[model samples]
Target: MFEGVDLEVPAGGLLVAHGPAGCGRTSLLLALAGRMRLSGGAIRVGGYVLPAAGRRVRATVAVARAAPAVALEGRLRVKEVMAERRLTGAGVTERRIREAFETVGIAPRGSDLVEDLGPLQALLLATALALAERPGALVVDDVDEGLPPDAHGSVWQALDRVRNSGPGPTVLAGCVRTPPPASGLVALSLPRRSLDRLPAETAAAREDTAT
Candidate 1:
């Protein structure tokens, strides 16, 4: 439950929603992706109004949730996921999917079951699926989950590259800690609100570096 939470993710830019637990970081991401409903507050995605135009917003936004909570249906295959993305997404080609898979570094045979991969690989697979959509906007929750500290840099670097790519998707990613130093990455820190005061309100401090 959060109120007075405002955010601005520039077109084709990267915004890192960084905060500790219980700070409504997950909620914010869910709300933006139209996965969660809000009681009040106007939200517009890619110029379309929210809740009313939620379907359009959803079409434009792709989400990759935390690995533990977001399971691939038992024995689901990698190629099948990419195939689904191609069917649902615009201008998606098999080569594009392969490129995304390569970028994520998960090259297990497409015949392999989702259960076969390790946690990190599964996360990467999910991420690759999202990237395959080439959506107008993408939201990835718990970007640093189940990843090594050193690998965290690679994740941020990848996201930054995605954001800076030519007319690529605008990205909003959630992380419990800071990401690697990079320009054009806006880090929005959700301030911890005391339960006694403003128990239902949430606020974010901008660490904008949009140059």
Candidate 2:
């Protein structure tokens, strides 16, 4: 719940939504990504209006939530996920998958099962999978959750590379506190309130980024 919330996010910039637990950070991210609907106001991304009919907004925006389950079948190998994504027309190539893994500093080992990877490795793999799509925008929630503090910097570096890559993408990260340093980063604070009063300009700005 965010009331009369207004924000300005520049193109190719990183926006960190910071607040305490249950303060609607994730909700705001989901709403902006079109995974959730707001009771009032509007959301647009990269000029594509959200909650629109037959819109391919999901393809343009990649979202990784906090403690997101990898949904890896026990029988599937690490490489199989990439294969499945390609078979399903996700356009994920072996080279792209390899590059994504390398981007996160993970070595490609096709023999490894998803269940065997440690927590940090699993998180990196998930991010690689998302990056393989080369989406125009990324919405990550609680990036630091469930990880040792030392690993946070590496993850932040990876995300920064994603944000600074060619043409790049607008990134909106949700968290219970401040995010690590990154170039061109902005912070937005959300306080609990009725969602109906959210600012139209801010919603439109979000839509522009999504587009």
Error of 2 at 60 (Å): 1.3
TM-score of each: 0.79, 0.81
The root-mean-square deviation over C-alpha atoms between each candidate and the true structure, in angstroms, is 4.9, 3.3
* lDDT for each residue of candidate 2 in 18-75, tens digit (9 for 90 to 100): 8877677777777666666666666667667666721466667776544332234546
Maximum-TM-score candidate = 2
Q: TM-score of predicted model 1?
A: 0.79
Give lDDT tens digits, candidate 1, residues 81-116: 777778866777888778777776668688877777
**Model 2 lDDT-worst window of ten:** 202-211
Q: Which pairs clash in model 1?
A: none
Clashes of 2: 9
After superposition, candidate 2 runs with Cα above 4 Å error: 66-76, 191-201, 204-211
Looking at model 2, residue 141 earns an lDDT score of: 77
Candidate 1: deviation at residue 59, Å?
1.1
What 10-residue stretch in candidate 1 is worst by lDDT? 202-211
RMSD from true fold, candidate 2 = 3.3
